[model samples]
Target: MLLLIAFEAAKSGLWPAISSALFGQRWGDNVVKGSVSALKNGPLCVLLNFPNLALPLMFVGIAAMRRLLGGPLAWAVGLMTAMYFLFAVRYSVSDQFMFFVPFYAMAAILAGLGFVRLSEAGKRRWLGVAAIILLAATPVTYSLLPSITQRFNIAVPGRTDLAYRDSPRYWLVPWKNNEDSAGMFARTAMEQVPPGSIVILDSTTFYAVDMIRRLEFSDKDVRLVILGKDSKMDAIPVGTPNVYLDSAGEGYHEKWMDEFATYDRPAGKALFLVVWKGR
Candidate 1:
């Protein structure tokens, strides 16, 4: 039943999402363009974009080692890792990579199983092998340093570079990416906008906005209209109060901006809050 609902939503939602010029055309264009790029660059290129090249091999190694040395539990972890790759390879969008969390968990399970087996194999003599693997893998994490990591694109030669070459963040320290800023923006929106106003936003900004509401921001009275997915300005009921909150970016809605009144101008290139005229 749930699958049926999900399928129906996809079928019905494509056009509405596309007409909004956010998800529909953008997604299709990306898939089409990425498909061509992937083919030209070959398998490694595609894998690099999705799992950063080393990860898929690590996943495969874990699965294979588990199958040879461990029992059913370890084997299952391997199988799950393989399964995730099967799906991920087909729809490997970087932004949508969060869907592969289960795959990562399974890979971790396999790694843990390997460590246990290594400990047992040589009666504690082979324990150092596991420690060595850990040491080798530690640097890969640093390879994700946004500065150097961002430049490590194997698909494009000369673009590849060491992960720590120019990175400022110290190795292995958790870096600030999304959590703090998203929360701040959500709070700002709730505090500035009146209750019960319609807050229209693009798909990306909508997630943070909705997340803040769901978590403790607590301004539940407002309605969120995800632009490019929901109806445009004409759909709002007469006399209804409405606000449009969009993050500043390539897809700035000029028509909406020209029509609406700027309610609150927040600092940074992250987001903007606007309201419909006379509301």
Candidate 2:
């Protein structure tokens, strides 16, 4: 634990700035509420996030508890996994499901150790191999089936939008590219702006723009501004035409919308671009 303490101490100075940037003003309250919600949904979260590794993780738990897994290596892996899980539960942010990746990696390490132990069992080596195959195939099947069905235009029963939205298929399948539409919109919006024009982006638009800019617009000369909760419009230069790309429907930029005289407000969609005519 001395190592953990030293690590925390070394980065203690960065905590305040990081927390402020990520959580904003109500960081403490949001963290407490997020932790409580995460604790309540911990089991469901684990199952959804690590469906393929669930069985192997159970084996790891059983082996650890029975002292079948001993030594410093096992202890270190367990400790690190616990820490990752705790951090995953505590910090709630946009695309919160992605935060479980680190915890999943740690759990996979423990699960790998469990598999190794099972393989060492002379009589149960075949069982261990079967278990590994089953675990590996689960994720592969989940990912491939949807892609194939969608690709061939094969209409599978109960594969509607509602079903995907409510089921684990939504997370497992990479068929839908929601960011494509947003990136297209961002590209079109950027085209309307001149060189050195300031482009203000909401959280959702920020992610889409960041991805597409690295790929297609590396040479584009434009000033990018991220619209945060506490963003001040007064700081922007006067008489400079600016673009406000609001992709999220949460009304994060609603208060500042009145300042823009021209905008393309799309119907039935959250994406829109507002051109701010500077004073």
Candidate 3:
């Protein structure tokens, strides 16, 4: 906790903003209110997300009661797993899939402990070995096999369509899925902007393109500005070269299209760029 506070302080001196954002300010943003309806299916989500480890985790409960892996460690793992599971279930974030990462890690630890207990079964050692093989091979069969077959040009059933690549349903299934092409489109769009030109990104496009720019085009000379809904035209400098990248539908670009001499170009799927010729 102290290290985290020190790191945050060193990175940004605005402690109040940081605290507010973490505590409440940003909590309601992008939350899926209907998540309450899906609470009953939380266990199903866990099983589907962590297919390889779901069965093994059953042993964690047994270990916790029998103290197979020591009382403290077993109880600690079980308690942490339960806490994280509940948190993931209750958190109403739209991108709730990412929040399961810590839960997965803790569950993996408990699964490992379960495997250890199973392996020590004297007469049913074969059961332990079989469990280990299934646990290891489940991922290979479901995730890697599809990827490998596709790489070698081998035809396989249930291999077509990557639309779910970005969805949580395929989080553990495919090895290298390309369902979400937004990143590729974002990169292509960003490359068209000339060096030293200002790039304005709306709320939706800011996160999508900013990450790609930092990772792939960090050396490109461009000033990036985030244009929020309440931002004024004065936020942009007058008589300067600027490119506006945003979603195709009604947005800042559409609202101000009549105000400026603009050239619209389709950058990629559901994304477009507007070259602003200052009025």
Candidate 4:
């Protein structure tokens, strides 16, 4: 069910690609490999039981360590650590990576089962669960994680006056990426100009929206700005660019600004707020 929640709202490439973009890093497109593996897993999950992922992982991780010898176990640990670090480097775990939570759960079970033994019925149950899981995964993953945008493309109207999504109430982007506020790097400078001043984050619409709701800011005359400037997101709304300030940079470029616009601690970006320069 938790898997399904992630599965339902899934977006592909957004996480992996965006993370790379934010960090000025890059990685293998991996679409071909991604597609192939997803396809292969479809059959595997279907043939086996749904693979009650979390439950088994908790059960097996400890049990396996107990049984495996020091030599091979140590090697396995080393290999896993290396891969994790590699992914951390050029690529990273992003929201899209959440899509893999269930799948990883499945993989974890496979690993644990390898070292520790289960009863015949336990094995059968596992397989049955794996099959059911594939059944769930096949359609859910197919709908959520597609190699191409066309796979999960949702049609939208160019403009819809009566649309609920267009309403100001709904306009407050609630997602992390929704463009609502100013970014951390530029907010102080923009705010320094005066009240009703607008500086844009150019991404993270929800962050911008949150600013409107929490601060005395308004989204009424929201304009778009793109997140392309040596800044974060290439494009964003003029009235409503996703801008915020972070303490990491502390007025320095590329610390919090040091890296790229991302969630930071001690201080974070403030959402885009506007003070009309023209009016």
Model 3: residues >4 Å from true position, as ranges?
1-45, 59-66, 69-75, 116-124, 141-183, 194-198, 202-221, 227-243, 248-270, 274-279
Best by TM-score: 2
Sort by TM-score, best first.
2, 3, 1, 4
lDDT of each: 0.50, 0.55, 0.55, 0.37
Pairs that clash in candidate 1: 20-228
Deviation from native of the Cα of residue 88 in model 4, angstroms: 9.1
| Decoy 3 TM-score against native | 0.54
In model 1, what lDDT does residue 52 have? Answer: 29
**Clashing residue pairs in candidate 3, if any?**
none
For model 4, residues 1-279, the per-residue Cα lDDT tens digits are 323334433644446444442332333454222344344443333223233343454345445544554657645554443333233232322223323344454445444554244533267576567746855665454333223333455322112221112322222122335432243323333333234333333243335433543453343333323333443433322233233332222322223232333432222223322222332
Superposed model 1: Cα runs more than 4 Å off = 1-80, 109-179, 192-197, 207-223, 228-230, 236-242, 248-270, 273-279
Cα lDDT of model 3 by residue, 1-279, tens digit: 235546776776668534533333456333334365346445545665566644555655455444766777666566666756666665565345565677777776666656666556552466656766877887666656445545787543221222112323234355546555557656765676778766666654567778888899899987667766423466554344555444434444535544664546542223344545544
Cα RMSD of predicted structure 1: 10.1
Clashes in candidate 1: how many? 1
3 versus 4: better lDDT goes to? 3
TM-score of each: 0.47, 0.59, 0.54, 0.28
Please give, for residues 1-279, the per-residue lDDT of candidate 2 as tens digits: 335455654667457544443344455555546755455545445665555645565466547633665677667666667666765666555445565676777766666666656656563666666767877787677677656656787544221221013233454454565424555556665555567666667665667666666677778886666776434556653344545445424444545555554555454333345655553
